[model samples]
Target chain A: MTYERPPTPGYDLGMSSSPIRKEVDGALLAFVARQRPNLLAISDELAPLMAALDALLAEGKRLRPAFCYWGWRAAGAVEEDLDGPPGERLHEGIVNAAASLELLQASALIHDDVMDSSDTRRGQPSMHRRFEALHRAQGWPGPARAFGEGTAILLGDLCLAWSGEMFETCGLDEERRRRGRAVYDLMRTEVMCGQYLDMLEGTRGEAAVDTALRVVEFKSAKYTIERPLHLGAALAGGAPEVSAALTGYGVPLGIAFQLRDDVLGVFGDPAETGKPAGDDLREGKRTVLVALTLERATPAQAAALQRRLGDPGLDRPGVDELRQIITDTGGLAACEAMIARYTGDAERVLAAAPVPEEARAALNALAVAATARRT
Target chain B: MTYERPPTPGYDLGMSSSPIRKEVDGALLAFVARQRPNLLAISDELAPLMAALDALLAEGKRLRPAFCYWGWRAAGAVEEDLDGPPGERLHEGIVNAAASLELLQASALIHDDVMDSSDTRRGQPSMHRRFEALHRAQGWPGPARAFGEGTAILLGDLCLAWSGEMFETCGLDEERRRRGRAVYDLMRTEVMCGQYLDMLEGTRGEAAVDTALRVVEFKSAKYTIERPLHLGAALAGGAPEVSAALTGYGVPLGIAFQLRDDVLGVFGDPAETGKPAGDDLREGKRTVLVALTLERATPAQAAALQRRLGDPGLDRPGVDELRQIITDTGGLAACEAMIARYTGDAERVLAAAPVPEEARAALNALAVAATARRT
Candidate 1:
């Protein structure tokens, strides 16, 4: 329905990503291309759904796939086989499995937006909003919002089903796949549970740092990096020690990555982040940074922070004030200190990790980029 | 959380069900028992979700699993394997696969309730309703309805994810499992697409008979019976001819099954059906019965029907009037005739099918029960 644009790679991380990005993109494109006719055969009206998914997919950076690829290489999977025919057979299967994660991510984001009543994603109208606009454009009967939310839910279900189908059909040998399958299963369940936990947190008046950190561990840290890496290593038939080492390297780095995201949620440029400034605060997310601020605030500052933290109508002045309070209370510095400590721990683990040479360099670069990204 | 009740076996058709029911229930109970502690490990607050799922699951009649078990048997899988050690291993795998279908059904029902904004399911508050009540009971902040819907969505996703995991880990040998996996994959996609089509139809003014039939074929016939039969047959490594025969018997029987449901929705006793009498009329479902009435109705009658079809406040008097219109238009008679014809067709196919003797008997009984049930 709109002008077709080729998918752009996700956040640059200031690194060359052509090789990994191409394979992941190729896998996803091929999968969707194959499903296109089947979906259209179901109904022409369904075409918009495919278009919506394609647009959303095009904006991904293949972050999970990249993590997966490097993890596989770290566990003795050869980099030389990444492009050649002999390597293509094994590499393609893993790539497809990696790409499946993107679909899973798409499913989660679509559903999450509906849950949050988010208006936009990736600088575009969120899925339900897009569908709502369609309903209004068509002058359809009944509530447009209900229709939009219903279709969005169904679309997300389709994506979730497709993600499973993709992974199961990824052509990996069953033995190697077993372990990865376990990780994949745990990752999916954990993410949903974590989301529930986060929702539960929103219902409460105050946030404990431990509760905030627990949410981080389940919702972001494990899902974003640890599980993907384990999934890749499992696919490569990594030994117990190799898997353990990847976990060791992954956890601290993933936590640091989330901390960086929390920091960026408040401080990053809207242009780079593709979100409104103070979007997290507007949404009333109980991030660890917010928890720390609550812990350290003076009485007046605490009262003000509590009053304004979840106020949906808070303006730029309010955000500036909150920022000043966080700074004055040392919440920002303490959070920065936590990020540095985790980054150091990750680097130390990577240094002693039983990984190949090239993989080590790539992983270190990724850790730096993950912890230090502005977007 | 409440007193546990043993799961009731699905519609009996006057046949003994203890053998099949025990195995299916055992598999489901064992699976849940295993996951309970792991879920609690994630967070104690998550207890209510598991409790809710357990309560929902406890009420199922295991219809899909029964169809699957019978299908497996028709394909020459041994009845003796239902009990003996060797038989237990193989039977247990199939049972788990069948149990997975129940979870899939649960997921669908949960989300479907949200979409339709239905208040009750299985004579109890639907998942969203339950969650809404929970929020109100706890005096939780924010919109209770939104919170309820969000949690229900996530819970549905969790069930969907668990269904896949259970299916993959059913422990069938890989080669046979591959064939079943393909069917499983197709079944999931088809059902979701069918649901979308059903929802889309609801947004339109009048449903055509042909369109209504298409919905029946996709949304119920294949998903409710044909696919489950095929899935079981596939797992048993049935020859193509056997699978085709099962489909022949299954398609008509499944369609008949849905027709029975539609009829019962209008005329059956509420106590027996577990729904209010004339619930379908109140919801304005675009069933074949409604389509036929539209085709045959006088202009005045059509106008009246259209005006009241989807009115949420339609009371018993309104239901009776609509019933009278349908009867006068011969919609009810035509629907009954169609059901009888399809049931006859199904019986003929089953009689001539090359299935094992005992299995054929069980299938015929199921068809009779499916088409003739008061519930």
Candidate 2:
């Protein structure tokens, strides 16, 4: 299903965002349309690749691009002043660059699904699962699962490569591009590194809360938010102070976003989160929330949690039991408190940052939505 | 465990290659060194990632870089007159850009190993095998195989991302960089597309000989030779005709090179090939040779070949039996004849192209070595 915003209070930006979302979506569609011929040139059979990518790209909230667009606006591009050629060009560049983030995010999600063996994404079959079903339907030889996984890996690599290509071709001047490229390059590296750490932590078992937070910082805070804002600011030729301020605002808010995601993973409605609730528990995610739960749980509870967590077959009843234990032990409450604190910090930074009022207000609304939404 | 040139007559490019190889290796080391701190900032545990990448980077023959460098030379860059500041800078840029190809190749090889489920690469345990061993050593949770495969996937991604970063930072002027970037972008997309086709072909059983050759053309010919030459020519501001000439010379030679590889996979000595003899048979690679045998084999022979191919446990006798069928069916001879035809075509193109004498000599030598070497 496409990303439909839930009717949650205090989350709306109070602006009809359809046009802006349309522009972002339009950029992605055009880019993929450009790739269709090349993919067909390889083989007509490869056309399904473009379709699969289109499906994956269709459902994103464009959250990264929103942060990027707002960050660019905050860095001094006037909302209603993009009428001159120079302003228009800059605006277009911002939109295209922001759109590139969605492609990058697609790459990450596709690969992440393969790594996690996820069966679904965006409320549809994950890329691998989709391919697996194709293989089975066609009675293809070899292991269907391996073919699906391998194809997904290549597709992800293609998206990752195109992310850089799209950003480079976004029509930014050399100076602005160079600045953005630094962030872009480092962001890709750091995110991969963060993912490696996340994978590593999963194997080590019962990591310290601090280590889990570090994973969150790199994997979520920096990748999903801080770097996107920095990329936008850099593209806009924002002052160093502006970048610093954006980082200050982005990091805390990103942390809150991830913290809320952790909460949603355990307790949010499946319909709202677009994921099976308690997935983090089932997948044995070494999240800060789980770490906190371990730290706070009694010996018996901790043993029980350890026994049930990471059990792939853990059912709905088991999920409820785990949830009850987490809440009873105040693990959920502590996680909620941390989310509130980070949200407060983000709001404080946004207010102090020398950003334009229009962007500030939108960003404030986004922060509320990101942290407080059921999804 | 390292790529070593095979002995061949009349194929030597005079002057010891140690200096050239060192420069390419140095470029990779410096680039990775620059990324080390950024990686560590994500987590000190990422140190293993750096080490793994370095090891994989260390052993390659740098064949693609050599092709790229010689291709640049073929585009009319003077050999001994690169003393002026401008020339020196261009030379540095060429070397760095050529080195970037090696990184891309590294990414391809690592990912290829994972997809093929190969146990070894360049005589050592493949990246996934190394990681699997590490997982076992650490007594890490989760399936060791999955952890290993997942880590290899991410490492391949990091290398792929870094390839672009290094290419962009190779210090070419914007115009030249833009020219090269076009080829670079298409090359990446096409190669991944080719990889997908190759993987797809593996599952479709015995496809037509033409289909298998199409896979070869994209997966190896264009990617390994033609595009690299075009990229080098582009970086040098070579005329359109230079690109045309390079393509004329590159495509046929690349095909021959891949044909030689197919032969080596089946018949070459293990020590010389640095891969197990009959590795291709065990992997059930859908090469042109396999296609040819399938086309020509009697019913019983075809059944035997189909049954033995892709069997992971196919032993030496099984390999010998398959080899006998291929030889009897004229598959091996036909493949050799095609290789000879392409080699002839490449030599003819080199003879007629307007590329200068020094580069022509090197290109002739490389073509000979590339197509005729046992390894």
* Fraction of the native A-B contacts that model 2 recovers: 0.76
TM-score top scorer: 2
For model 2, residues B1-375, the per-residue Cα lDDT tens digits are 122343442122221343556788899899999989988866778888888888888886677887788778788776553442563467678888999998899889888999899998877889999999999998977789988988999999999999999999987767778988999999999899999999998987856898888988889999988998889888777888888989999999988989888888999788866789899999999888888888889999889999999999999999999999999999899999999999999999889998888778777777877877776
Tens digits of per-residue lDDT, candidate 1, B1-375, equal: 111122322354423544666777778888888778877888999999998898888876577887887788888888676553542368778889988898888899899889888877777789999989998999977678988899899998988888888988887767767889898888887788788778777876547988888778877888889999999999888888878888899988888888888888788787776678788887878888888888899999888888898788999999999999989999889899999999899889899988998888788777877787776
| Candidate 1 per-residue lDDT over residues A47-103, each given as its tens digit | 887898899888866778878877788888895665635423677888888889998
CA deviation > 4 Å runs, candidate 2: A1-18, A80-88, B1-19, B80-88
The lDDT, on a scale of 0 to 1, for candidate 2 is 0.84
True contacts kept of each: 0.48, 0.76
In model 2, which residue pairs have backbone atoms overlapping below 3 Å?
none
Score residue A206 of candidate 1 by CA lDDT.
48
In candidate 1, list every pair of residues with a backbone clash. Answer: A10-A61, B81-B87
Off by over 4 Å in 1: A1-10, A13-15, A80-88, A308-328, B1-10, B13-18, B80-88
What are the RMSDs of all candidates, in order?
4.7, 3.2
